[model samples]
Target: MPTIRPSGPADAAVLADIWRASVRATHDFLSEAHFTEIEALVADQYLPQAPLWVIEVDGSPAGFMGLSGAHVDALFIDPRRRAQGLGRSMIAHAARLEGKLTVDVNEQNPQAVGFYERMGFRQTGRSPQDDAGRPYPLLHMRQE
Candidate 1:
């Protein structure tokens, strides 16, 4: 099993790479301008404030999860490492920290929604726009 550890300053660059690769792979609904804009914010602003934890696969960073209180702020895996259970491991680690977990999934990402459902999260609500007022719809979910 993979171990989850608190992120250090050194993990920032790789985490940003994972974020970019994962987002580009799954967030095709994002416009070029929107993607670029959010990328900068995540790399410079949001990531710095997030309580991040990294999962190493084969002695290197493979993915990470960001937490805010009991809510999942963000979770991303290297695009090449998807379907390898890295995401599941990250979520399990998050659950261990707080038995109850909440996350907002982009509605257009059915794969992510289904994965979370398989992991026992259920939809609690919906929003027409993301937290940042982006046009992407969001589906709120909770694991309890």
Candidate 2:
């Protein structure tokens, strides 16, 4: 059985590792530089207002999910633990929250887009780069 529990700052290192590995494995379509940037962002922001849930399988942390407001800011399952329903469970948990839940995924990440759709999210729109100059096509999906 897998258990989902709140993660604190203490879990940052392990969570960072999971985030890196998961992105590298599933996001091969992304550029190496983009991947590195994604990993760095997660490591730098995986605390405080963005709450995370560590997924433990048989007493060991195997994955994590992060939440911000009603959005699932991040969700990653250890590559080795893929296809075991952990992602679905985590998304379902997030969907149960109040208000519409939203997530922004890169346009190239079809698997993630499909996963979110299966979790009942519908494409809302697209967000281009903001004034900060960070560039990436953001596909917005929302569920109410």
Candidate 3:
């Protein structure tokens, strides 16, 4: 099992890299411009602003999860290190902190949606655009 720890602003650069790598692997529907824009935001804004936790495997950072109250704002694992239960570990850690987690998943990313569903989340609602008002649709989900 992986251990989770609190992350600070100093971890943003590396976490942003993980976010880019993970998104590149899973979010194949994103355009070049959109990817660039979102990447910048992840590094400059999101990672710094959100309360984050880092997941370490074998004493190295492998992934991160960002939380806002009971909601999951973001979760990303390094592409090379994915599918090894880092994501599941992060979610379980979050569950300990906040019961009944809620998350917004990108509808175009079937991998994420399916993963969330397999984690016992159900779609509670849908939005035509993302929280940032991007064209990508979002599925609001809550763990049950």
- For model 3, residues 1-144, the per-residue Cα lDDT tens digits are 678999977888888888888998999988899999988888898888887899988887899998988899888999898789888988988998999999999999999999999899999999999878889999999999
Q: Per-residue lDDT of 1-144 in model 2, one digit per residue for the tens?
A: 898899877888888888888888877776677667767766886443367888899987789887887878788988899889999888777767645688888767788888888878899998775223456567898874
Query: What would the per-residue lDDT of candidate 1 be over residues 1-144, giving only the tens digit for each residue?
Result: 566788888888888999999999999899999999999999998776677999998778999998887898888999999999989998888888888899999999988999899889999999999988989999999996
**Full candidate order by lDDT, most accurate first:** 3, 1, 2
Question: What are the TM-scores, per candidate, against the unseen true structure?
Answer: 0.95, 0.85, 0.95
lDDT accuracy of residue 29 in candidate 3: 88
Per-model clash counts, in order, read 0, 0, 0
Give the clashing pairs for model 2: none
Worst 10 residues of 1 by lDDT: 45-54
RMSD of every prediction: 1.1, 2.3, 1.1
Candidate 2: lDDT over CA atoms?
0.79
